[model samples]
Structures are given as C-alpha cells and as structure tokens.
Target chain A: MKKINFSAGPAILPASVLTQAAAAVENLDGSGLSILEISHRSDAFDAVLVEAEQLVRELLNVGDEYGVLFLSGGASTQFFFTAMNLLNPEETAGYLDTGSWSAKAIKEAKNFGKVNIIASSKESNYDHIPRGYTVPDGLKYVHLTSNNTIFGTQFKEWPETDAPLVADMSSDIFSRRIPLEKFGIIYAGAQKNLGPAGATLVIVRKDLLGKVNRTLPSMLDYRVHIDGGSTYNTPPVYPIYVMMLTLRWIKAQGGLEGMEKHNERKAKLLYEEIDRNPKFRGTVADDFSRSQMNVTFVCTDEADTAAFQAAAEAAGCDGITGHRSVGGFRASIYNSMPYEGVETLVRVMREFE
Target chain B: MKKINFSAGPAILPASVLTQAAAAVENLDGSGLSILEISHRSDAFDAVLVEAEQLVRELLNVGDEYGVLFLSGGASTQFFFTAMNLLNPEETAGYLDTGSWSAKAIKEAKNFGKVNIIASSKESNYDHIPRGYTVPDGLKYVHLTSNNTIFGTQFKEWPETDAPLVADMSSDIFSRRIPLEKFGIIYAGAQKNLGPAGATLVIVRKDLLGKVNRTLPSMLDYRVHIDGGSTYNTPPVYPIYVMMLTLRWIKAQGGLEGMEKHNERKAKLLYEEIDRNPKFRGTVADDFSRSQMNVTFVCTDEADTAAFQAAAEAAGCDGITGHRSVGGFRASIYNSMPYEGVETLVRVMREFE
Candidate 1:
C-alpha cells in the first residue's frame, strides 16, 4: 500500500529524495564508492558540504555574516550548547515556555545561566502562543521555539527584543520564508523537513560566537564547526549528503517562498475540513496560533476516537496517533507532506463524520 | 566497476548490509513506509534498537552491569561526555597518549577535570604504543584508544590497573573478541567496523555512572541515555537502523571469533607483502604493535608514490591514500574488507615492484 506518513519527526521525506538516497547507498555520484564507504575528507563529500551550506544560505537569504553548520546530536543537545556558548554563568537569558521543547530548552539554559520565563503558554496547556512578552534588557539572548511539534502551536509574531534572538525551528524550519537577519542563531534537526535524523542545521551570526566565558568542549563549540567547515572531527557524511539532495529538491520547488505556499495550502485544506466536520474538533483553540507544520485534533464524541483511528489506518494513514503526553490525533504536514495526502486525510475525516 | 574500498573510517560495509539498508530506505520490511519516514517511537524502530543492542551484548559477552546506548554526535563528543560523567573536577583521570585520537580525547578531557598522561609515544611520532609506564593509584579512570587508525597501531594487551578503563575503539570494534569486564566503558563511532557515519555505540558499566559531581546536560549524561534506552530524544534512526543490519550481517559471518580469524588472515597477507616487497616499508616499526584494521606503508623510492596511487586507482582500489598528517599509503582492511581485496592490493604492490 502507498501510505501517507504523518510522523512528527524522523518523519516523511520526499519520495524522490528516498530514491536518490537509496541509489547513493549503492553508488554515490558515479564515484565507484558507496556513499557509506567514502571518506568525509574526500572531494565528493566536500562538494556535498559546500552545496548544502550554500543552499541553506540562499534559501534563508543570509550573507557571509552567518555561518551554516550541519551538526549531529540533534536539537536536544542544542538546548545546552546554545546557552553555554552564548550566556555566561552569571548572565541571564530570556526564554518563552510555549511548549514542551521550549520548556526543555529553558531547563537546560537554567543550568548554564539564569533564565527568566518572559512569557508562558503553559498555564493554558500550551494551546496557543503567549502574547505581549517583554524582552528584558541585559539578557544575553531571547530563546524561543518557533513551532511546537507536540502542542501544534507556532509563534505568530516574534517579540521585538533588544537582546539577540535564538530560535529552535526544528518542526517548521524550511516550511516558510524566515527573517534571518533578525536572529542571532537558528537551529533545526534535519529529520522533520530537511532530510534524516542524523544531522542538525545550525545558522549563527559569526560575531555572536567567541564571546562565551567558558572553555567550550571542541564538539560543543559552534566556533569549532564554523572554523573547520563542520568537519572539525569526522562529520555524519551520509546524512549531510542526503540533506544536500533534499536542498536540491527544495530549490527546485522554489525555495522557502514556494514551500510556504505549498505548506499553507495543505494546512488550510486540512483545517477547513476539521472545522466543517461535526465529528472532529481542532486541538488548538485559536486558528492564528495553529502550526502549519503539525496539525492536531480530537474526535468530538471521544467515544469515536478508536473508530476514527481504525478508519484512518484502513485508509493508509500512518502515525496519526497523538503524543502520549497529550491524547488526540496529530497530522504532521511538514514541507515534504504532499497536498494529496492532506486531501486524503480530509476525505477520511469526512467519511468518518 | 565494483571497487574495493579501504577508507580508514566511514569505510566499506558488508554488501548484504548495504542492500538491506537501501531496500529499507524504499520500503521497510512490509511496513508500507520508508524506514526514513518512521518515528523512533514506532514499534519497527523499537525492534531495531533492541536487536542491535542484543547483538552487541552477544558478540561482546556482556551482562546487565553494562548499558549499551546508540547515540549521535560521533565519538568526538564522547571525549568530553565520558570525562564529565566519570571524573569530578576535584579528581583526575589517566590517559595514554597513543595517537591522534587519544590526544584529541585528552584535550577534551582537560576541560572537565585534571588529566595525567601516564604514558606517551609522541616522541617517536606515535609509531608504537608506549610501554614501561605505571598507572598511578586513585585516578577515576584510565583512558586509551584501542586502535590508532592514523598511526596504524593496536594494543596487543591492555594496561592493568585498579582504576576503571575507558577505550575509544572507533576503528577496530567488532573485528575481534573483546574482554568486556576489563573495561568500564567502550565507545565507537559506527562508521568503521559497525555500519554508518552518524550513530555511536557506547557500552558503559552501569556502576561507573552517576559518580561525576558536575551538572551533566541531559544529552551529555549517560544516565539519561541508559534510563531512556538511548531514546531520551530523537535518535539518529537511519544510522542506527543501518547498524542493526550490519550487526545482523556480522552474526551471519559467524560471530567475533570468526571475524578475528578473517581479519587476521587479511592483515597477515598485506603485512607479508609489505615486508617482502623491496619497493615498500611498513610505517610501524614494531611488528607486534601494527594494527590489523589499518596497515600504513610507504614506497621506498618516495618518487613511486604518485605512480603507485594512480595504479591503485586504476585497479579499482579506492581510499588507499594515507592520512595527510603522515604521507604514503594506508590500506584500511576493516571487518567488511574481503580477503580478495587484500590479495589484490598485495598483487598491485608486487606488480609495481
């Protein structure tokens, strides 16, 4: 069966990317070497790193002031690395606890430096983004999660801050056009929309680094990667190569602006169906705060949840089960999720209704 | 043409492993979804993680005292994580400066706590493992690199010490049987003998954890990984899946003992050619210290280097070029390297002579 995967992360990739990646595993770009067997220092891999970085720059519309690094260890590690590199132990940083990911980042940041929760949507079960948050002066950076994969909420507007901004854009990184110059740092784990699970893309303003007041571990330091072109130590080559193929696909799809149009169409189609169907209720209270990346909802009668789940499964939908922490259905429509998949999901919802 | 790959790390993997991995990328075991699209929390991935860990335990003959974690970020990040989790800032750890990898680990360890160099071979350009050095008492752990990929040296016997031992077995893991009880921790980047370039296999004794006084970040802490079953966050799923497939292949090739016999035969063949050929000289002076995983040699005329490289390239031998730090040729005969490849390499050397 041709199934539509809606996994929140380590999620669906473009079908063409998967095909090319599989072939590359057998033989990479006619190099007579399997992509698995090639050295990271080889000219073949060097081209992959260069092209992937250039695509990230061109898509984000960033200039030389930004250093793009494809790292491993995921965004879970970035929570600590971001704070450790940007904030001194005695310094304070502002964080918005919008959802689970941001809350985790805030916890990690607190271990390195003092962290002030400038705004929080936790009191309302993170159903919407908090508004009117004050970015206090003297804060090293204002940390935020651009989109909550678990809660299915996204920041409609970023706070106007005196301090530099650091955003974890894991779920919605390339789904829309982003303002690169407004932020000091942006990082995303590649599994969602970029490529696979092994690489994280970190874009940082060059001047914002080297100011940390501690001796950073070589792997933990962003400066080490910026200086060495993400090969300070042996990098995760296969993942980066696959990411390059994905960027190539994204560029062909018209970059981030085109991605926004495609993703918005999918999101609107699903949301409209959710509102029209009497059997389903959207999880997020306000439509403005709903994420274009992950769409969450619940069966209105609650008793029909099982029947709806079975129906979706029978209709060839995968990973529609909601997060265990929050009980409901979540349909992740990342950049790669096709319009037809969303339409199929709507058809299933209507049939269930 | 199918080429014989000899890259030191991120080198050749089993042909069957590659085929299975490639197929999984398209459609995983009748799951109706690409392996790249599945969630780490899914049952399919859970089986992969379990099987990979079970295979490691069976091959290494380890018991419940150890925790096997499939982590991201490679072995480089482990340099600091190992130190941070084992040695408190007030205490010290012992390290043997055997080669480039161990030296890198020592530099990272210094950021966490005091490091005492118990022995070093740098005076001889890391041509052999240092001997006649005593391990001081009261150290937290004694760290070593089991195989020097760059210098082409391997430890024939481990240093005896009351302190817990830590080893970086990045290049030679699974090529032979290991004494798991003798070491408190063993870590390897999976690119070498295991599978791909993203996942790292960490087997640590449970008792050795939770001893460090520092506040370990959730990602850096071994306890978190152990408790969470290496899924505290989204793991490098594709790499881990590839590793599982490779481990399956290893079992089919008979276990570690079978691997030992196979690798020994390949290494002996190449080393014999280096010793007999008038045109070449092995890099490592001591015969007993030479590594079976990577064999480094130099052309006697030095001028013949270019011709030898070209001839090897023409003969379908890939990645035989040595590390830039030291010039000449390094034929990395990792576990996946077949005996025919080594025979071909030896034949190439003889023809040149």
Candidate 2:
C-alpha cells in the first residue's frame, strides 16, 4: 500500500525531494562523491548554503539585515542557545507558555536570565492560545511558539510587544507568509517544514545580536556563526542539502501563499468531518486557535478507538495515532502533505461513523 | 574517471555503506517511508538506535559502566559540555594543548573552572606531541586530543594521571582499539572514520558524572542523555542510522584490529613516499608523533606547489590541497580510504617527480 504519511515532525517530504536527496547521498551534483563525504567548506556545499539562505530571504521577503543560520542540535538545544546568546544574566525575558516546547524554552531561559511568564494556557490544558498578555517594558525579548504540535493550537495573531520578539516557529515556518520585520529572531528545527532533523534554521536581525552583556562561548555565539556563514564547525551537510532542495520545492509550489492555501484546505476538510461526524470530535476548544498544521481529534466512543485505527490503517493512513500525551488522533498536514491524503482520512472518519 | 577523496573530517565513506544509506533515504528497511520522514520514536528508528549503541559497545569493548550517547552540535559543543558536566567552579582541570582543537577545548573549559595547561607543543608549532610534563595531583580531569587533524600529530602514549582522563578522539575513533578503562570519557564528531557529519559519539563512565558543582543545563548534562538513551530530543536520525551502517561495515572488515592494520598500511605507504621522493618532504619533524589518519607534506620547491596540485587533480585526486593555515599538502586517508587510493596518490607523486 502507498501509505499516506502524517508524522508530526521528521514528517513527510516531497517525493521529488526524496528522489534527489537519495541520488545526492550516492553522488552529489555529479562530483562522483556522496554528499555524505563532501567537506562543509567545499564549493558545492557552499553553493548549497548560499541557495538555502537565499531561498529563506526570498520566500519570506526578508531584508539584508537578517542572517540565516543552519545550525546543528534540534530546537531543544535552541531552548538554551537562544537565551545564552540573547538574554543577559540581569535582564528579563518574557515567555508565553503555550505548550510543551514553550515550557521547555522557559526552563532553559531561566538558567541564563530572569524569565517571566507573560501568560500561560497550561491552566486550561493548552487547548487554546493565551491572549491579552501585557508585554512589560525593560524586557530583553519576548519568546513565543507559532504552532504547538502537541496541543494542536497556534498563535493566530502575534502579541503586541515593544521588546524584540523571538519565536520558535518549529512546526509552521515556511508554511505561511511571515512578517519579517516584527521579530528579532525567528528560529525553527528543520524537520517539520524545512527539511530533516539535524539542522535548525535561525533567522535573526543583525542588530539584535552583540547586545547581550555576557561573554558567550564561541560555538554558542550567534555572531560567530553569522560571521563564519554557518560553516563554523563541519555543518550537517546532508541535512542542509536536503533543506535547500525543500526550499526549492517550496518555491516551485508557489511560495508560502500557495502553501497556506493548500494547508488550509486540508485542515478545513479534516476539521469539518470531525465536527460533522458523530464518531469524531475536535480536541481544541477554540476554532481560531486550532492549528492548520496538526489536526487533533478523538473518537466519540472510546471503545471504537481500536476499530477506527484499524479502518484508517486499512485505508493506508500512517501516523494518524495521536501523541502519547494526548490520547486521540492527530493528522499532521504539513506543506508536503497532499490534499488527497487529507481526503483519505476524511473518508475513513465518515465510513467509521 | 572515479575520483579519490582525501578531504579531512567529513571525508569518504565506504561504497557499500553509501549504497545502503542511499536506499534507506528512499525507504528505510521497506517501511514505505523515507528515513527522513519517520519519527525518531518509531520502532524502526528505536531499533536503529539500539543496534548502533550495541555496535559501539561490541566494537569498543565498552563495559556496562559506560554510557554511549549520540549527540549533536558536533565535538565543538562537547568541548564545552564535557567541562560543564565534569568540572567544578573552584577545582582545576588539566588540559594538554596539542593543536587547534585542543586549544579550543581549553578556552571553553576556562569558562566553567580554572584550566591548567600541564603540557603544550605550541612552542614547536605543534610538530610533535609534548612529553615529560607532570600530571599533577588534585586536578579535576586531564584532557587531551588523540589525533591532531591540522598539525598531523597524535598521542603515541597517554599521560599518566590519577584524575579521570578525557580524550577528544574525533579523527581517530573506531580506527583502532581503545583502552576503555583508562578514560572517563571518549568523544568524537562522526565525520572521519565513524560515518558522516551531524552526530557526535560520546562514551562516558557513569561514575564520573554527578560530581560537578554547577547546575548544568539539562541538554548539556551527560546524565540526561544517558537516562534518556540519547533520545533526549529527536536525535540526528539519518546520521545515527548511517553510523549504524558504518559500524556494521567495520565489523564485516574484522572490526578495529583490521581497521588499524589497514590504516597503518595506508599511512606507511604515503609516509614512505614523502620521505624518499626528492620533490617532497614531510611537515612534522618527529616520526613517532606522525598521525596515521592525516599525512601532510610539502613540495621541496615552493614554486612547484601549484603544478603539483594541478598534477594531483589531473590524476583524479580530490582535496589533496592542505589547510590554508599551513600551506602544504594533506592526504587524509581515513578508515574507508582504500589502499588502492593511497597507491594512486603515491603513483601521482612519483610521476610528478
């Protein structure tokens, strides 16, 4: 069977991207060498880095003031490095606790500086994005997560803050148009919409750096990577190459505007079935806060869970099982997720009902 | 013509391993999903992680007292994380300054505790490993680099110390048998002999941890990785998978003992040519300190450098040009570097003469 993939992150990639990446793993750009064996400083990889960075700027309409870094360590490490580079020991950083990832970022930030919880949806079980949180003055930066993969909520609107905005857009980056001027730093782990698992993409406005009062470790310093052009250490060459191919795929699919339309259509189709079908119910309370990337819901009858899963499996739906923390179903419809896959799941839901 | 790769770390991989890795990128073990798309928590990846860790234990003869972690951010990150987890603020850690990587390690260690330089070869321009330095008592741990990639020197013998020994074996790991009991921690970035870039192999004795006074960041803490089985977050999935394949290949080639014999042969052949050829001379002064991984030399006439490079290129030799810091030639013959490739370079050198 041709499985319709719905993995949350390290999720589905475009078929063509996979084909090209597989070929590159054997021989990159006709060099008679695998991309796996090429030096990070090689001209071929340098060209890959250039094109990847260029695509980030062009797709997001970013200005020259921003620097795009392809760094190792997933967003989990960024939970620390972001604060280590941006927040001084004395200054306060505001973090909105939306879900698990935001909470992790808050914990790591506290080790560096004073972290204030501007707002948290934890009391409500994070089914919706917290709103009306006042952004206090004299803060180093305000951190927010654009999409919560686990809780199935997203920030539909950016919080108004005078402090420079720093967002972990791990799940929804490149899926929709991002306003580049409003943030100090926008970072994402590359597995979701970017490419694969090893590389994290950090897009920071150059002016926001060099302001932190601590003497940073050389590898932890954003300025070092920006200066070295993301080749500070041997980079994750294969992941970065795959990322470049992904961005190229995104551009061919009509950039973020076209991606937004595709994602919304999939989300709408799946969500409508959840609302209409008696056997299924949407997990998130607020419609506006529901994520377009991850659609979370549950079987109406707990006893029918097994049967529903079997039906979905028989229909070639893969990774529809919900996160372990949340006992239900989640169909992650990222940029590369075809409309047909969502339709297939909707049919499963209807037939199961 | 098929080119021979001689690039330093991020060097060549075995052809059979490359074939399997390429196929895995398309569909890992017939999962009908690209390895790039599978979740790190999936059964297939869990099996991969288990097998990879098992292979490391089997090949290195690591006891149960040690923990194997596949980490990210490369060895550059470990240069700091090792100190953060093992060194206390008041105590001193002894560092052996071997070359660029060792110097970088020392600089990062100073941030956490007092760093003492017990031995240094920087005075000799790192042409040979420094000996006769006392391993003073009451030190937190003694640190050294096993192989100097840039300077072409290596530790022919380890310095005796009562304190736990930590070695950065980034360039020489798995190419030879290691005495697991002599060291508290052994770390290597997986680009040279291990696999590709993106993953770092860290093997640490469990007892050596939990003694540091500082409250380390969770991700930086070695204990966290050990407890979580190196899946603290989504690991570099593809890199780890490839490392497993590389280790499997190593086992097929008769493990570390066989690898050591092969590496010794390649190094002996190239070094002999550098010594005998009228047109070429070795860079390192001490014969005993020369590395088996990287063989560096220079043309006798400085004017012949460009022509020698062109000739090597014409003969299907790639990345023979030396690092820019030291203007000469470096032929990095890693584990997967075939004996035939080394012979080809020797033939090129003789013809050029």
Candidate 3:
C-alpha cells in the first residue's frame, strides 16, 4: 500500500527535502562526510547556517530589522525564553489562551512575568476563538499561538493590538504567508513545517530584546544564541541541515506565497469533502473555527469512525486517527502534504459516506 | 572511499541505529505510519518512552535512588538549571573550569548563585584538568565536566569532595563505567556517545529537589521533565528515539563494561601512534588526560599538520581536524567510532612520520 501521511507536527516534509536530507546524511556536499560528521563551526556547515537564516528572511521578506536564530530546544523553550527576554518579572504580559499549546506557553510565561489572560475560550472548550478582549495598556507584549493543532482551530485573522505581538507558530508556520511585520517575535518548533524536531527557528525583531530585568542563562538567552550564530554549542547539526534543505525545497516550490495557495487548496479539498458528506460532520465550529492544517471531523455515528480510520489506513492514508482529547479524525495537512494525498483522503471520506 | 567518521558529535552514530531510524522514519512499526507523524501519546510510542528510560536505568545500574530524565534541551540548558535548582540565592556552587563548555556553564550558573572557581586549568590554556580542590563546606554542589572535548582532557579520576558532584559528561558519557554512587547528578548531552543532539540525559539523585528559593520555568524544572516522563510537552521525538537505538546498540556490543574495554583499546591505538611518531606530538598533558574520546595532538613541524589532515581525509578518516581554539589535530575516538577507523588513522599518522 502507498503511504499517505497525515500525522500532525512531524507531518509530511517535501519528498525532495527527504531525498536531499537522506543523501546528506550519507555524504554531504561530495565531501564524503556525513552531514552529522561536520562541525557546526566548519565553513561548509556555516554556509548551511547562513543560507537557512537568509532564506528565512527572504521568505518572510523581513530585512535587517529582524534577527533569525536557529536554536536548540523546541517551542516549549521559547514559551519561557520569550517572556524572560521581553518582559520584566514584575510586568504583566497579555496572553490569548486559545488551546493546549497557548495554555502551556501562558503557564510557562507566568514563571517569568505576570500574565494577564486577555481572552480565553476554555469556557466553551476552545471550539471557537474568543473575541471581545482588550489588549491591555502597559502590557509588555500580547502572546498567542497562531494555530491550535490539537483543537483544530486557528485565528482566521490576527487582532490589531498596539502591544508588540509574539507568536508560537510551531504547528502552522510556513503553511501560509502572514504579514511578518505585525509581530515582534515569531518562533516555530521545526517538527512540522520546517524539518525535524530539536531545532527551533526564532525570528525576533532586533530591538525587542534587552528589555527584561532577569539575568537569563546563556543557553536560554536569545542574545547568546544570536551572537554565537546559533553555533553556541554543537547545534542539532543534522536536523538544522535538514531544515536548511527543507527551506530550499520551500523556495523551489515558489516561496511563501505559492506555499500558502498550495496549502489552502489542500485544506479546501478535505474540508469540502467533510461538509458534503452527511455521514461525516465537521468537528470544528463552522466559519469561526477551522484549521487549514488539521481538519478534524466526526462520523454522524461515532461508532463507524474507527472503521473509517481502519479503512483509510488499509487504503494507505496513515495518521488519519484523531487526537484522543477531541475524538473522531484529524487529517494534518501540512505544507508538505501533497495535494494528491488530500485528494486520496477526500476519496476515502466520500467512499465512507 | 569508505568514510571513517570521527566527528565530535553529533558524531558517528552506529550504522545499525541509522538504518533502523531511517526505516522508522519511512515506515513506523509496519503500521504504514511514519514515526514522525504519530502522536507521542500513542501506546506504541509510550512503549518507546517506557522502554528507553528502563533501558538507560538498567544499562547504567541506576537504582530507585536516582531519577533519569530525557529532556528536550541539551546539557547546555542544565548548566544553569542545575545550579538554580540546587543552590539558594545566598548559597554558592563550586566549579572546576577545564575548558570551553565548563566555562560557558559556569557563566550561566553565575546568574543563579555565587559561583566559585574551585580550581581552573584555563590559565594553562585548558591543556589539563586541575589536580585537587577542597569543596567549600557551605557550597551546595561541586560541578565539573568529566571529559573536555574541545581541549582533549578528562579528569582521569574525580575529586574527593564532600559537596554533591555534578558531572557534564557530554562528550564521553557511556564510554566507561562510572561510579554512579559518587555523584549527585550526571548529565550528558546525547550528541556524543548516545545519539543525536537536542535531548539531555540527566541522572539526578532523588533527594536533590525543591531546594531553590525562586520559581523556575516548567521547562527548566528537572522535576517536571522527570515526573512527566520527558513528555511534559512534545519532546524531540526523533532524537530520543534514535538515542534509544544507540543505547540498544551499546547493549548489543556488550553494555558499558564492554564499551569501556572497546573504547580504551581504540584510544590506546591512536595515542600510541602520536606518542611514537617523531613528526606528531600529543597536545594534552600526559598525567591528566582523556582516553575514551577526543585526543588532540600537534605536529613537530606545525606547517605540515594541515597537509597531514588533508591526507587523513583523503584516506577516508574525517573529523581529524583539531578545534580552532586548541590549534592542533584531534581524533575524537567516540564509542561509535570503530577500532579499525582509529587503526587506519594510526597508519596515516605513521606514514606522515
């Protein structure tokens, strides 16, 4: 059976990226040296570092105003470091707690600063994005997750807040082209869109740093990672190199604008199928709540959902299984999930109906 | 040419581990699902977590007295966290400054508590480890990195100190059987001797918790990663999975005791060549030096060393280039590096002589 992956986060990467990464692991740049074998300080690997950051700037169209850092520890690390670097311990930071990831970030940020819950939909079980919350004055920054992967909901539009905006775009980054200037900092854990786990791509507006009153650890300090050129220590070399390859793949596919359109089409194919089939009902709230990446839906009869999953697996569409917290089905349609794969998923949904 | 990888980690991982990891990435557990796609919360992946922790404990002979955590951030993060967790704001921690990693670690620890340089070989250019130091009675702990990869020096034997000993054996962990009872904590970044970079292996004694006065970020809390089974949040899944395979390879090659003999033999072979060859001279001080990994040496005629490194690479022995700071050649004979590779290096060294 042909494998069509739908697993969230370490979701499908561009097949070309995989091919290049696998080849690099064996022999990088015809040096007969495995990408894993080269030092992060080496000129060859340094080029990988420089190109990755440059491409990130190019993709976002951000100029010298922002500093792109490739650092260790995933987005979870960023949840704390962002607060530690941007907000003083006594200062209050506004947070929009949309789902699990945002909650985790809010919880972590609380350790570093006083966090004000600007708005939360936990009262409604996060089915819809909360509205009607004021972006408090004197707030250090307004923090929010761009997309909630587990809940399968996203903020269709970002709020126009005067406060500097910070986002943990771990699950939905690079899937669409957003206005990069709207946020002070945007970081993504690379398991989903960029490459593998272990590496985090932190793009911070240069001037937003050095405001926090805390003495940060060197490793956790964004300035330290920035100054060290992300070679602060032997970086997660293979993963970062693979990320660079994936970024190259993104560029080859016509950069951010093309990827956004491509992702939208794939999301539409699956969402349209879910809505058309009476046997299946969309899990997320209509119009106000929908995730372009993770399309969650339930069978009208939940009993048949397992059968549908098994059938989908038998048909070679993997990771169609839904999250246990919100049961039914979730098809994670990352940037790398080919349109053909979504077409296959649509076929399965229609066949099930 | 057959590549003999001696890169100082993300160094040479076992070929078997690589093959299995590649296969897992392609197809996980014959479920037709890629390992990257599946939820870490799944029963299948949960088994990986349980078995990996169990395997490390069993391999290290860690009893109920110690808690083992596989954390997302590398040992670099722990450089501060460990101090913060153990040392009160008024208390001080003692450190032995061996080389770059230790110096970096000490710098971070200074943010949390008073840092006392109990001893340092930095004035001597980190070519050797300090001989003896009395641990301050009021100090919370005495921290030291057992093996200094950048400088090619090891403690050879640990200090006889009353204070708790914390070892960052990042480069040479699992290369020898540690007297586990002597240290309160042993942390190793998994890039060397274990698997890829990103995850840190922390072996901390059960008694050392809830001591620090200040609140720590959840990510920095060792207790969180340990109690949460290293899945407090989404872990560096691939890095930890690959590390498990590397651990399995270590066990198959006769565990740590077996690995010790294997490592000693490999180190002896290369060191013997450098000692005997008139053209090449060993860089580290003979009495206090490393054996299991990271052997640095220089040529009698320093001008010819560059040619020798080129020749070594041409001979398919890569990563023999010395650290820029050390200014000489280094053969990091990590556990995964085959004895045959070292022998090949020895042959090249003798030919140069």
Q: Please write out the lDDT profile of model 1 over residues B1-353, one tens digit for every residue.
A: 88999988788999988888888889999888888888899899999999999999998898999999999888998998899899888899999999999999999999888999999999889999877888999999999999999999999889989888899999999999887788999999999999989999999999998877788889999999999999999899989999999888888889998999999999999999999999999999798789999999999999999999999988889899999867799999999999999988888998999
Q: For residues B1-353, what per-residue lDDT tens digits would candidate 3 score against the true structure?
A: 65788877678877777777766766667866556556666676787778788888888899988888887567887888788888887888888999999998898888888999999998889988877567667778889999998889987788787778999989988888988888899999898889877678899987888778888888778788778878877777777788888888998899999899999899888887888889988888764565459999899898997799898988988777888888878888898988888888998888887
Number of backbone-clashing residue pairs for each candidate, in the order shown? 0, 0, 0
Query: TM-score per candidate, in order?
Result: 0.99, 0.98, 0.95
TM-score of 2: 0.98
DockQ of 3: 0.53
lDDT of 1 at B172: 92
User: What is candidate 1's lDDT per residue for A55-101, written digit by digit as tens?
Assistant: 99888898999899999989998999899999888999999998999
**Position A277, candidate 1: lDDT:** 92
Estimate the Cα RMSD of every predicted model relative to the unseen true structure: 1.0, 1.2, 2.2
Which order, best to worst by lDDT? 1, 2, 3
DockQ, 0 to 1 scale, candidate 1: 0.84
List the candidate 2 regions with Cα displacement exceeding 4 Å. Answer: none
State the lDDT of candidate 3 residue by residue for A231-282, as single tens digits: 7776777678878888988888989888989988998888888888898988
Regions more than 4 Å wrong, model 1 = none
